[model samples]
Target: MLEEIFREYDIRGIYERDLNETSVKAIGLNLGREMLKRGAKNVSVGYDARLSAEDIFGWLVSGLNAAGIDVFDIGLLPTPVGYFSVFNDKFDANIMITGSHNPKEYNGFKITIFKDSYFGADLQKLKDEAVSTIKAKTQIKDDFRAIKFDIASEYKKFIIYQFAHLKNMKLKIVMDCANGAVGAVLPEICKSLNLDAEILYPNPDGNFPNHHPDPSEEKNLKDIKEALKGEFEIGFGFDGDGDRIAVLTKNRNIKGDELAYLYSLVMKNPRVLGEVKCSQNMYDEIDKNGGKSFMGKTGHSNIKKAMKELNIDMAAEVSGHIFFKERYFGFDDALYAMFRVLELVQKGINLDAELEKLPKVFSTDEIKVETSESKKFKIIEALKLELAKGVKELPEVKEIIDIDGVRVRFEDGWALVRASNTTPVIVTRFEAKSEELVKKLQSIFMNLLDSIKKGM
Candidate 1:
């Protein structure tokens, strides 16, 4: 078992290379034991459309059963549906086997113990236990001992009923499923709602022949954007496991923070949570609109934990992970977010018009600098120290927010440099009042980061 697979948020790595039968079974066994310690009796397991999903599922189940925990196989489904199974009170714990917008050869597990995300320190503990005690030649069982469950159908019905109001709504929209797990249920839900929608790449293909299953990249939304050029009023694109979303109009691709701003328009005094990478405009706009905005760390697990602690109604990441607690479960679901966007449209709220009202600020998309996992956090620490000492080349510092990494607030804008919890990369973003300022801030920050990297 490679320790690198035990990430801050979840366990992920290349199949066979790091997540083969022996390693995956060991992970399942250890994870099952931890679940039992927490008083979890049974876990609902689901997988995405990854080619190795079935093989991994079998191995994982064998290990879980060896740990004396019951397993409910929810079959192929989106990550959100797996979350819904837990929130629906059908299982004590849940594990979704998905690559989650990663390359097809990669796969991983996203775990939920009851409603809480099983991550961070707990994940580290699991790693320690696996490394110290678990054996390399763990026995594999032929029988999976898993009971088949149709949670996907249940989740689809629940969604359809929840958004029954959108039935036969006169709105034209297009969806790009990216050939991931969302294809399993979204089309059926759309049909049941009688939505005038066109769905592209609805078939679940682990190969992802259409485009990469990530909608956050501008290139992936090309087909959907091209469809929007016709009579389609809106476009929605989804990532592999159907958790993240990209909302696009004829003019703009609405990001997660921007989506939160739009969702808050109809909400009364909404309590919204945003991550460090969110634009300054998002925070200021929400605050100015009678809503309370709070910044938290950048992972879904971090955001969800913060939401529970802060009693927040909504939370969003700029990369399209939006969570809601106002009227539904506070888990990130792109399908659920799609309905909410439809609700906004149903209320006659023009999506593009509402966005245009926000203060125009130039912002750069997340810029990632490749680095080794061991050096990423060290670089972040060095950058923070340098900023604290006040580098002359940098702009005047208003404040340094170290909630996650380092978000340096400037007089005109902000610059952020943080280590990606999942990947071996340093993530950076900059926002300013003008394009020129944005470029300048990015240049200075990158230069400082380069110096820090060189010194290390």
Candidate 2:
């Protein structure tokens, strides 16, 4: 019944194999029913530049039609634009077909309901309904009407109008789109802003022939950085869906915490929120600036919901999901983030200079420890048991925060080990005051992990 692809957040799997015509159609029907049951009148849909996205869309349309939901087709746009549809056209729900950072072989859907993310139990409910209906041989209408929607232009105009002041700033910016859906909307926005922008792999190539569509990895920025030989001021990179962003200065890529710190300085009395993965500097800077800060679990949906619950105006995750309720709608829009940086530059701020002021710390980019799907959680559980039992035995770990998973805060800095909610791996990152401390922490954690694995 295609339950394998239905994850805690969204539906994702390989093309034609895990997400074929039958399974996808059934999944769409389930989403449509969920929309109807939740009292949504229509759903807006968009997709990335994947070869199979075109055909898979047809199956999705069929399911929406069967559920009697009107379809507004905004073809080949970013997920953020799909998110905009719910607000732009007053639609009840939005769905984006994208594999996100995954390779060309993968494709999936990210869903939103009434502006909030549709995930967790909500996702499970859809899977259950899809499977049960398949078992019962349920009946649904086979027809759906999709009208071409010009959301890209409208979204572009909105962004340009909002940041019209940054136009003609004469600040050169290099962008790497990774041949994803941003190809349709990003360049237009940049043009409107009068940004001296140079784009790499801007065309919508589903194959991603150059590299995978993930900017979080520093290696992925190789070409873009090399292109920045002279003083380009900054560089911007986008993921497949264009909701995640990687901000770069001339010297180094700025993590999400760095962005929050800069933004907090500009935003008056800003209430900032950073996910557990965010650097400690973000929180410290916000506190120093007389602004309040809070920490939450990582995930775009989780952060969005947290923003609403805690009345936070802005939020950021290490993966570069930036949500702004400060002045506009609360959602992660990478295109918008690019312009905001331009405005910051216009205000006589240098991104790298600001970051250099912070105390230096040693950190590692996210290290993914691959494990089997069935064994990932078991490993975490066993490790948790060891930590709890030998709290005094292991003097290295001073604190254990299992808010999302386990984030151990130490005196020097901190280390985190969390089972990825979206992937079958233990995602880890460590930050310390010195390089030696970072290595010490990483070794300590890895040794514990190896020990636990060997039943030592």
Candidate 3:
């Protein structure tokens, strides 16, 4: 029973090792009890392509049933589909069993209740309850069976209708499903809309034999790039649970913030929200286009909450998590975002050309420094203290945003260093007007982080 599995964003850990039957059943029972306390009577459950997903579902349902919570099983589907079921079916709660972009040995649960993601304090409470139950050695007996329901077709139909204008766009499209949850729905949806797309790894393989399910890594995108080089005008890649997306032009990979910028061009008075990690150009461009722009804390849960509270039309993270509330539900759906991107191209908006038009700035991909989960946050705090002490010696700080992590703003660019909530590492990113400036900022921050971690 590793308590560390209960993460900030979701409950995740190595399968069998940390997410054994005992821990998982405890999680399910605690979650069910918590949902009931929140006035939730029923929950729609789903899983990704992982082989253990079905087994985990069985164990999870037992715990839920023991707590007298009705379970509506959507079987194997993307995480977003579980979110979709909650809205379209009016389910009181929803849970998606997925590892997301993590490796094969990892698995976890993403939970939602009353339209709000069950995270942060909710997760902490659940963890505490589960640990208490285990300590008390409570035996929960299963009482009810799960009811099977299919939401894939309905979700696909809804997406097709939402973006019907993109039907038969005749653009050569290539998609890499990465053998994740997208295999079951993405192809059929594309076919229904008459999209000329070539799908790679359309089959759902939990092993992910072709490549890793995460498309954010450049190495995992090699297949998609290969296909793009051979007659594909555009490429799309999805994470393990089909929530995050990686958009690719023939020549370049389009990032989430850039995608928001492109989407804003077609929208009338768009209100876009981006994470602190987003580029300054995205914020400036949205404001320049008569739209509202806001920078919020990084993380899907944080972005979603801000979007709902502020009535934001769209939100994005630099890591390719794009949420749309303009004409669709306010959730990060890669499949839906793909259509929006195609809609831009279908409506004569040049994909690459539009991106090229944005002010050019050099940026680094998310750089991770390995550290223990226990030490990661401590390192960040130490670095923060050091930065404050050395403020006079460092480059002039225009502004420092500590919404999620520490984002130091310089006149020319900015640098961010934060502890990754999902992994045992410190995530960092830097951007500046020139490559040299970006490197300089990153070096200073890296040195600070290294010294702090060593001290710890």
Q: Name the candidate that leads on lDDT.
A: 1
> Lowest summed lDDT over 10 consecutive residues: which window, candidate 2?
389-398
Our model 2 lands, by Cα RMSD against the true structure, at: 1.7
Error of 3 at 185 (Å): 0.8
- Tens digits of per-residue lDDT for model 2, 24-59: 778888888889888898888889999899878888
lDDT agreement of model 3 with the native:
0.88
Candidate 2: segments with Cα more than 4 A from true spot: 139-144, 391-398
Candidate 3 residue spans exceeding 4 A from truth: 142-144, 391-393
Q: Order of all candidates by TM-score, from best down to worst? A: 1, 3, 2
> What's the CA error at residue 248 for candidate 3, in Å?
0.7
Residue 50 lDDT, candidate 2, scale 0-100:
92
lDDT of 1 at 81: 96
Q: Name the lDDT of candidate 2.
A: 0.84
lDDT tens readout by residue for model 1, 1-456: 488999989999999999887788878889999999999999999999999998899889988998899999998899999999989999999999999999999999999998999999999988877665455555656558899999988898999999999999998999999999999999999999999999999999999999999998999999988998999999999999999999999999999999999999999999999999998888999999899999999998988899999999999999999999998899999999999999999999998998888888999999999999999999988887887788897777899999999999998999999999989999999999989999999999899988888998
lDDT of each: 0.92, 0.84, 0.88
Clashes of 3: 0
